[model samples]
Target: MPSSSATATVTTNVFEAGKYTTVLQKVESRTTCCPANTSPPPPVPPPKPLLIVMPCEAGEFPLLVFLHGYLLYNSFYSQLLQHIASHGFIVIAPQLYLVAGQDSSDENKSVTATTNWLSEGLHHLLPPHVKPNLSKLGLAGHSRGGKTAFASALEKAATTLKFSALIGVDPVDGMDKGKQTTPPVLTYVPHSFDLDMAVMVIGSGLGELKKNPLFPPCAPNGVNHKDFFKECKGPASYFVVKDYGHLDMLDDDTEGIRGKSYILSVQEWEVQGADEEIYRRSCGCIYESILGR
Candidate 1:
């Protein structure tokens, strides 16, 4: 098991020599410090498709859908999506929970419905300034959402959505039943899916969930990223951020875990220092794959 105290020493330059923050720069007046607010959210008229973030720029930009982890709201990833938008991409995040109840199988359908909405209904719903390129699309998620991303990519053949790239961040496969197989999360993992597009999995070296001092560590060793990387076919990239915890990818306090760093000497701010770097590297790959660069 990797020690929580282990510090990241080997830092390979993820960015190319000439390309430095040229694509993804933090937007001014809109820092990552912005809070997540689902109240007064974007209108989700009939058919009930959750709409999170849509860029104001009107053009044929690649559309990237971010799936929120179980029990987490879509607003939690606003900063991440906005960072991608800054780099010229159209991001759409949908709330995948059902007020009645939720199941692992629900995510696949949620993604499919959202994709259908994007291709058929988005133009009628959004303002005239918002334009999305449905042809070039990508799927990304965190935790259970990450598993959902994998599922969606694998099941893309059933939907009209054509995903060119897929990304998973610290994705976890959910619990399993004795024999029943109602929900897919019970046995789902990246390796279970057949992906044709370029793939990337971003994992945390410190799998412990120390954000809450009271809660025990829940992340399983190797199951999150290593297993996924090992299962990936064709060309793929895996990045493990040393000392970073499960929820460190979110904005400063979106999850209240950022205030309490898992490591004693390192503060939460320090653990999150590599988040932007990770986003840049992943988005760079997505952009390249979508545009065929």
Candidate 2:
């Protein structure tokens, strides 16, 4: 069981180094050949934004929503999304805001991000079947987005949504005025079995989320993600990738971040870690936990 006093957070590869693929890259674009005098039509604003709906076999699918970390936009988290969607669950990663620089300390924006994600799902964009099964929904986020995931849960609980589970990817809790304490109050940590699901977290080298009071250790040297799983309440697992920084989890390649922190300098070419593998296994745990093997 996770200690009642505080929850654990891992932020290692949550923002480490790597070249994350873009969402636009996964989207199929239909190029229209225009006549020499023809002009492109004005872009139409969609009432409901498209949630990348990747499907697997004809079975009933569980909803998996992801919130990306700070500095990295939602579109850049495609590698992680594709990996999870491949495991048989439909996934949605909404681009809340694009965090591009250092010194991230915005709480209002964080709150808004959560609200937007909830709105995106509850909007008319979803299939009628997906709208009613709140019991089959799972919410996951990385870095600042992870904290936003918590906020999103609170919003949904107060409204017409009730998620099946919550997973934070090295989520950021530091900027929320110590709201990490809010989970034990609003969250009823799902059962180890019942489509009740689990909230297993994933981290890398420094396997813990920063800005979370529940996470007493931000970056534990040589932290073993497997060891943390023993303390986890889910019928799931925790993971710490070897030789990875925070951004590696995404597909973005880091050139200047190496100078920001010594830990961010590990080269993917020389490292032995698999960020995608860890992400796949973690999300897969969510998939299996929700739908059962």
Candidate 3:
């Protein structure tokens, strides 16, 4: 029922915001508690609330469960999530944890719980007349969160809701090669992941380079985006923004010293104009390849 011109417009504008007005909402989980008189407390659910962004208009849209980076708050990605939502998708980003060590096993479990809660709790939280199409559901994350996304899709955690697409934005496994973190997802083998879903890996050209002598590169070599893309099988796409860093996709007003530094770097790239074009082209390619625009 769609016309060719409308499809063409979508194909050409993949890098820009779409034609929908979006709304953002933070939903807290409904927790139940037992009487304090009980001898021992029953197991409580993980307190992983969601930050949902979706179209304000009445329409059915695909859903993407986005996970935050290591120790990063879900609110930091407000701009990026809203951009995707404007493109007619509902993005649910969960605060997996307040603090975490090298182990991601618990984070993986939290993701599973959030995905399962979608069917029962999501509709109630969405805007009136707006619906989510679980069949076209996607899972995406940035930095260490990207590693978590891949692990969850590989069934490292028991997930009842199947994900149709997976995205990793400069995912990092550990400090360096052969030094992978606990429950490592990369096998160091070509096309080793058996995700059985469309995959997209977005890398940053500067991620493997050290920002200073004091700290290691945010996304170190051998365990970063390049390694992730190498192991992905067919029905996959890879994009690397040559002028960006691991945290450049975040909101411009992202707080903290690291955020300020990255914001300046982004400004430099924008001033050049050419770097921004390359970034846009890379993102547009991703939409065409994975979303079939």
lDDT of each: 0.57, 0.45, 0.75
Candidate 3 per-residue C-alpha lDDT over 1-293 given as tens digits, one digit per residue, 9 for 90 to 100: 10111111233365766777677776555452234663332233224767888777798888888998877788788777766676777888998987789999998888998898787667766656998887878888899999999999999348778888899988999888888888998999999999788999999887788646666778889899999999999888888887776766666567786556544443322223334334534553464357542
Stretch of 10 with least lDDT, candidate 2:
1-10
Judging by TM-score against the true structure, name the best candidate.
Answer: 3
Looking at model 1, residue 139 earns an lDDT score of 84
Report clash pairs, candidate 3: none
Which RMSD values do the candidates have, in order?
9.7, 11.9, 7.1
- In model 2, which regions exceed 4 Å deviation? 1-51, 56-59, 99-133, 154-156, 175-197, 207-237, 252-287, 290-293
Report the lDDT tens digits of candidate 2 across residue range 13-39.
322211221122122111332336854
lDDT of 1 by residue, 29-73 (tens): 111223576223223332333434444445556778888765666
**Sorted by TM-score, highest first, which candidate order results?**
3, 1, 2
